[model samples]
Target: MGANEALRVAFRTFGCKLNQVETETLAARFEVAGASIVGPDDGADLVVFNTCTVTSKAEQKARREMRLALRRNPDAVAAVTGCYAELDPEALAAVAPRTVVLPGSRKDALGGMAEALVAARLEGLDLLDELRRLAAAASGGLPDPFSFVPGEARFRSRVQLKVQDGCDNRCAYCRVCLARGRSVSLDPDEALRRATSLAAAGVPEIVLTGVNLSQYRSGGVGFPGLLELLVRGVPSAAFRVSSYEPDRADAAFMGAFSLPGVRPHLHLSAQSGSDRVLRAMGRRYGRDDVLRAAEAARSVRDDPFLGADIIVGFPGESDDDFRDTVGLLELMRPAWVHAFTFSPRPGTRAFDMKPRVPERVAVERAAVVQAIADRGKLEFARSRIGKTLVAVVEDGGDEAVLGDARRVFATSAEYLKLEVRGVPAGFHGSCACRVIGLSDGDGSADLVSIFI
Candidate 1:
């Protein structure tokens, strides 16, 4: 690619909402530096893979996608980054030809290097070699994990405002903490400023995200305090928390739900509900903590959509331990349960633990959890059959279709998927939706709404 020619860049992101936010930020920078952001299969000159290494499967998927992207565009150069690259750069670097690995810590500099590469007008293997050399040099030092790079590219309806990075906890099964290092938070003032700016720019909603959102602290401001600041500062925009840890869902944290404009949806990082399993996993909180968090959220918000992440078949987990997890789920009845089979990652404490759970057993437990989750979702959807709720239009137009029919897809404040109809020609904002019925195909609540 020459300086005069705009580089066609495609991005494939994996893992948390934090990674998605970072990918959007990178795409904005590339667009500013005279590059066209294209789809993964659109045949681009450069492709960026924002990978995840939370589990072996995530890393495997990253590798597979990287090779597929390269195959789709035979002459494309690849730029890999995120937790996977941070933990195993060499593995990603060797995945395919004409690829360079940029670790998570030094991700902010990737755009600058790409700009320089574009200006250099080098192509083929030469460009990839130079990018690799630059990545090696940039990997020498640690970076400010909470570094902010401003951009105006609003790719999605809800903008993700990342206020924190890294983690302080040493959860036995997690490899992300090792890759991201210690906790680092963005300044509260800066966070507020960014939120206000996004709201002013006509962005309807902003999602606060971080690797460990509950661990956020800066200048005597905690996550709840920062949340209050943004809610008060930007009255025009809605706010959502990406995910939070169960132990940190204290009184103060729950109080944020009472604030105006705060969305009534919460996804907790409740790895397991079994006290014994939680203890073995090095989690500080017990099963009661998760219950209390759920209770607190319900007490504050009106039928809030409570979601959680639960790991099945962890090291040394017994039948009783698994029962405890299911019992907790029965009590909470979370709208969404992200049931995951424990994949022991290398470099984590759980990797070498003895008496490993059989893969077949793990899969069975996951299926059980998933069944309960699906039932909970259906029950929740049924309960809202005749209620009117606030929803944000995610995808809709005159020609928008849902499974062969025309419909507008929206997400309610309680995080329910709504297929709405009978609105304006191109409705795309927050509105009051009346749940009419449920769709037979996907079970998404059918609704009717108009732009507010």
Candidate 2:
């Protein structure tokens, strides 16, 4: 490829924030390799599809995108990588005959992959083996040094940084551990260095994300120790942690939120609220532990936007179990509920368990749980109606503006209108907004004005 060949490339990512950060890192590598990044419609010479197989739906979506990419650029070299590719290489290869499947481990060697593709050597088995082997060899080396790059993020106002990778938990319903492999924490000094760069880039917020973030430990620095350093070391940007296990929600974790730069929102994964169901799902903690964690967070910060991920209709889940979950939600009244219908993953233990709930029953239970979740969110938002919230101005359009400016807003989609009475001006990017009225629907808010 000539230096001015203008090797246009496009990427589509699916799944969590860690995937996003990895994609960005890949894009950076591509740019360094002299590729011009472009949109999907630009008819790029190369297309990279980052796949996610967290759910059956996610797998289907990834396959659909792969096919679309093939159709969009039939002659263009198509590369597939991510958790889905790592878990099932054959499935990804079947998406397109010309598709080159790259294992997740090979993500760091993407610059070499790009070079091989440009030379049309991305065609045969030998090339694929070489790519895989190169990735395997590189995996043993220390993480390639990375610095946060500044630009307008396509998806959100805030950017996520992967301080660590992989998971140690074997939750019966989760396949992440299998896809990501064993838990491996990034070096603490490198993590802090990256955080400092992100802060320098004027990223207002940086969410620390990973498969099992609580298990992060490097150089005797635990998650909390790293969190303290990030908060104290990089005060220019707000910090947030992604989904965490309930057992990891200890006093030290709670104290991290007390830091001024730390976001008060906490997303704890409480898959079930019944002790029997928890044991069946192989969860480490019981329902009571979840409740206590919620209480502790509330104690630290009044009405913190606490969130939970609840799975309904797991194998052998009974009516009493469902009611117990409802009771727990009623008691804790989390800011929001991420209700998921139990879909048995291929390799998970839950897939083979007996007493499976019917598909219709699972759907019904999910709906019921969602109704309860809706009420909890409404109550949480109502509680903040008269309170002033630090609103991060996400998108300032003609009709509305939104963001996670403070702990008062229950939902990230909770946006305030610019036309509302008593609303102030210049609330375009990460400004505080006073809550005037609740939105008609529970999903958003009605702000009177932006507070300077």
Candidate 3:
């Protein structure tokens, strides 16, 4: 690797849509530095894995990806960053010894390090050793994350627009707030500029994502205000927002649906339905609050795709508490639930809380919630049948028709997976299709062209 010779860099992201968008931002920066971004499957001179640590399983996956990157390309300079690095830098550093570990605190400086690493390799210096030393030398609390702008023409349809970063809520079971810091939103003007650029580049959809998406606040404009600006500035793009606490949602926020560009989907987090458990977990809202938010959202949009995150086994939770959670899900009838078994992270308030649920018990409780979730997903998918949905096609399949149908993969405005047929390949732009039925495959929806 030398200044004259272009370097190949590959990225593997494992977390939220925000992480994915950040990876794209990093890739764009690498390209600006004269590096070619390649897939992880391909051999590359350097690889980066943006990791997650919301759960033990997520951390395990991040460590595994770091190790796999090294195994796939033994000579590759591997770097790990994101939540896992921010939460547990030592663990990630120990995972792939000699690899560069950049904590979320130092992520902004990463763009400048790409060329430095390449230059070191060319100088016959040990790149990994030098990078790891540099990682250690850069210490102290990280400032607010640098504003990242995803490439204008990054995807065919959906482009994730990160309008916010960090969180303020210190929920007992969450380490994200400690790792991510206070909420800081993107500037509305800069956000609108990015949105307009994406629309001009032919992006059909833009997914607004962040650690605390609904908590976005910058220049006296909140998430809803920012959304209105994006919608008005980019008429060509449809927008979908990722998850936030249920109480963060209200009529004012959901009312943005009046704009056709704002998609009808709310990935809300209702950690636990039991008021006692919620109180213990330091959650700001109760079960009823979640229900009201859902109702208010529905009032704005007839039937939006409502999904939630439900943590099952927090400390001091009794059977009645667990039952209350399940009951609430049954009553709310959300489109789906992201069921996560409690993983006690060190330094979190809940870590030392008494009467911790046994691991086996927590696993069983998670299964119960997931069963309800599975049924909810099926019912939601079935609802799409016989209705026309405006959707954008993804390019996972070749442009060829099978029989009388073209099995084009797509996603509806509400973030539902769709297998669209009868739409021409040349029709690469967004299109309206009538959902014919559900595929046997999980999360699969079948759609046909509405027009002859």
Candidate 4:
């Protein structure tokens, strides 16, 4: 890159909403530092990969993508960070050339590094050497993913505010806890301040995200208390809660659902519906506890979009146990479910468990669960045919269209994907939309809605 030319940067994030938030924050920093942001395949001068390690599949995908991105832009500097990088920096460093491994703990250095790179306009071996030297000197510290750099511009319609990070539970099959360590929360006052600022900036929605939201606590405030504070303090911006623990879904926690500002979408970290499977997974709650949480969500809102995460074919999970899981889900009639086959992480207790479910059996069970979940999701979308929802336009402009369809894509407050029409050209931000029809069930299973 020449000194007169601006540095082009690309970002690729793999994993949860938390990782996405971190990527956005880093991109904002780079942008504010005068770096031009481009797509990963746009032949950028720098490519940043914010990776995940929750599943072996995720790590493998990250490695594959990293190699491809590096190959496409061989001279581009690749700065790898996040959980997978934190766990095994050496493995990621070996994936591609001109790579700088900055683990999650030391990610705070990215902003300063971006500023330096823009100022010096370093590239090729010189840029790689500088990044390596900086990475080695960077100390351990987790950056607040929600915090933005000074004068950072807000472009997205919705913001994911990560008020907490890490996990306290030692779930048997979970490697994330080992990578993230104990829970840490942003101070409630600071959280509220940041949320207020975001809402004031015309961000229509704010999703409170964390590794485990149920473990949030700071300045004598629990997760429920923090929710109440944010909901009441920023009534202008709609709120959404990310994946949370079932055990913590107590009366107080459920009360937050009653607030009008809080959207009617809730996803529980219910690993299994079978009590035996739950026990083996080292979960704190049982099957009935999950049911209670679901009931609470239903009681608070009309036809709320309820979701759960299920791990199938865990060690010692018999057919009967799987049946119990199906039964529980059937009773709950969740709007959506994320079903995954058990993945044994190297350091987790479940890795050494006996009488493991065969890989073939696990795959078959996962397929069955996924089929049911897909049907449930389609049914839920169909159920909202005549209902009006608050939706935010995520993509599509006046000139951006698919074939002859001049429509924009949006997401309802309940998290329903919508193929919206009759909105003005270049529409962005929240609007009242009524579900009118369903899209063709060919590939895109989105609900058809129109602006009222």
Give the Cα lDDT of each candidate: 0.83, 0.72, 0.80, 0.84
TM agreement with the true structure for every prediction: 0.94, 0.84, 0.92, 0.95
Candidate 3 per-residue lDDT over residues 211-260, each given as its tens digit = 88878999999888888888888888898878867887876687675578
Per-residue lDDT tens digits for candidate 2, residues 1-452, read 33336567898999887778878867766666556788766777678888887888999999988788768777666778888887898988887776777666555556555555433332333433444555556556543323323232333456677777777778888887887787887787887887787677666777788788889988998898889889899988788878777888899888876677777788888988899999999999998889988888888875677789999889999999988988888887876788888888999999899899888988898898788877776676666676666655554434323442322232232322322332234433355555666665543454334354
Order of all candidates by lDDT, from best down to worst? Answer: 4, 1, 3, 2
Q: Compute the lDDT of residue 403 as modeled in candidate 3.
A: 49
TM-score result, candidate 1: 0.94
Give residue 422's lDDT in candidate 4 (0 to 100): 77
**Residue 328 lDDT in model 3?**
91
Off by over 4 Å in 2: 1-4, 111-157, 395-429, 439-451
Which sequence of candidate numbers ranks them by TM-score, best first? 4, 1, 3, 2
| Better-scoring candidate (lDDT), 1 or 2 | 1
TM-score winner between candidates 3 and 4: 4
As a TM-score, model 2 comes out at 0.84
Scanning candidate 2 in windows of ten residues, the lowest lDDT window is: 410-419
Residues forming the 10-long window of minimal summed lDDT in candidate 4? 142-151
**lDDT measured at residue 64 in model 1 versus the true structure, 0 to 100:** 96
For model 4, name the residue pairs that clash.
Answer: none
lDDT of 4 by residue, 356-420 (tens): 99999999988988888888888999888998878998854445354544577788988888878
The true-versus-predicted C-alpha distance at residue 196 of model 2, in Å, is 1.3
Best by TM-score: 4
lDDT of 4 at 188: 93
Model 4 vs. true fold: TM? 0.95
RMSD of each: 2.7, 5.1, 2.7, 2.3
